[model samples]
Target: MVQVIDGDTMVVMKGEESVNVRLYGIDCPEGNQASGREAWIFASKLADGNPVEVQPIDIDRYGRTVATVHVNGRSINEELIRSGHAWVYTQYCTNDFCRDWLKLQSDSQGARSGLWAAKNPTPPWDFRHSFKLAQATPQSSKPKAPPASAASYHGNISSRIFHDSSCQHYDCKACTATFTTRQQALDAGYRPCKKCGAK
Candidate 1:
């Protein structure tokens, strides 16, 4: 029997070996290293320290069993999202409820609740990659810039065919007025210039 731990990792009591089970179809915030404590608290409440059935769908490279846990005949994964504690792992989720989970996450983000309260929260997978990179490299190192040729030009200015700076992607000649900031123009409901569209 394994007890649900967090969104991703779990603890299974298997005789002497304590198996760490990783749940599928959900990517909870990192509990230990990055908001891991909060994640753990959320997961514990969801699991309530009870024994859960670990239905394995696959085994991850780390030998952790990837499973969809069911407790009291309810989908723990769905509960996590509905409670605004976890997000659907879009990269790996195959369940039909994935769309619903995504919607739940969107709603939470719009409401600025739970994990969404963090400013510019990174996805768990991306956070792991960045953590590894930081551990392997020095922070003082500067990143290389892209080549100048990689830059793209809009178009040649002529015959009053200029892109509205407000809407760079739209070439609207009717609204050629450029504002100091794009937000200002967008607030006025002005579309891109018809002649030269800017994005």
Candidate 2:
């Protein structure tokens, strides 16, 4: 059985188990974004209960199997682009064939179909980034006291990395663990996060 989660996400049943798949190389709008519902409807028709072949690309931090999905030997990824349901996610799309997906997106944008019907469609990546920034932004305009540690360091157990409290990533969701000093993080086998100037 194939189940549709959203425009670019789905689950395929294998007897007693199932696999969660995220379509690779393309990014669709969020569930609440403009034309988001339309994209889901299109994707549901393409993959719902239909046989598909997934080419595993990478496992994201969220543990989603990112891959290109083919339904009835047709590239669902390409179809989404050709119909303006998604944009080429160039950040992680370094493969040679990604160029074709980009071209398809360009054509779709020119035609202003589906999500492209909007004069300026906001990419889902940008939307998520803005949302995260909003969520991570402190609610009060006034500043709060920093971690009572002598030294200023923020640690994330999941990534096993530490960031300078002055760094923008310091108060990220994963960075619940605080460190008094850089040495304290190093002693705990936590390295510095590259995003921040943790050297």
Candidate 3:
């Protein structure tokens, strides 16, 4: 693997190409969410610099490859759940193997491991939904400065999405394009990030 981007995403070399793989059946905390750093550290320890096996499952809306990664025959997706670093992501975990992962999640929760240690840990999906809502809310009516000259926005050429600096995905590998303002990105046919409210 080239590097571990977050708790559940990593860049792996496929021939001469680098593919972004989102671990299947699990959802980790976002970079700004609770236990997010710890989850990334754990995943980094397990996968970074280690050769892994990727079993492709599907392609996500963001153009990420959803797959189960294995290291030394151990499933990293399952390990994340067992270690309490991620949730079962039941929305897409329809296979029978998900049952075992669900059990692991329950056990982790019962043990109060990792993020489960929180009094009421927020799921990543719920946190993302809240972020989206907060982003949608109107801002101050005060006059804002004109669009800055510096390129402060990152655009994902493939996904056609743009993200500001505040976004965890602002430096995503696919975000090779840059824009001086949100309007520039919009005019260039890019949309705001759903996670960070880049608009």
lDDT of each: 0.57, 0.75, 0.80
| Residue 102 C-alpha lDDT in model 3 | 98
Per-candidate TM vs. native?
Answer: 0.60, 0.68, 0.74
Cα RMSD for candidates in order:
20.9, 12.1, 7.8
Model 1: residues with Cα > 4 Å off, grouped in runs: 1-5, 14-18, 32-34, 138-199
For model 1, residues 1-199, the per-residue Cα lDDT tens digits are 5543345566666678666567788887653234544665666666775667778889776566778777788777766666666778888987786787788878888887767777887777786587447546754756454243221111211222223323354332232122223333343234435644533
Better lDDT candidate (1, 2) = 2
lDDT of 3 at 30: 71
Task: In model 1, state the lDDT of residue 93.
Answer: 88
Q: Which order, best to worst by lDDT?
A: 3, 2, 1
> What are the runs in model 3 whose C-alpha is more than 4 Å off?
142-199
Task: Give the per-residue Cα lDDT of candidate 2 at 193.
Answer: 85
lDDT of 3 by residue, 151-189 (tens): 267777567688986688987767744555677567646
C-alpha positional error of residue 115 in candidate 1 after TM-score superposition, expressed in Å: 0.6
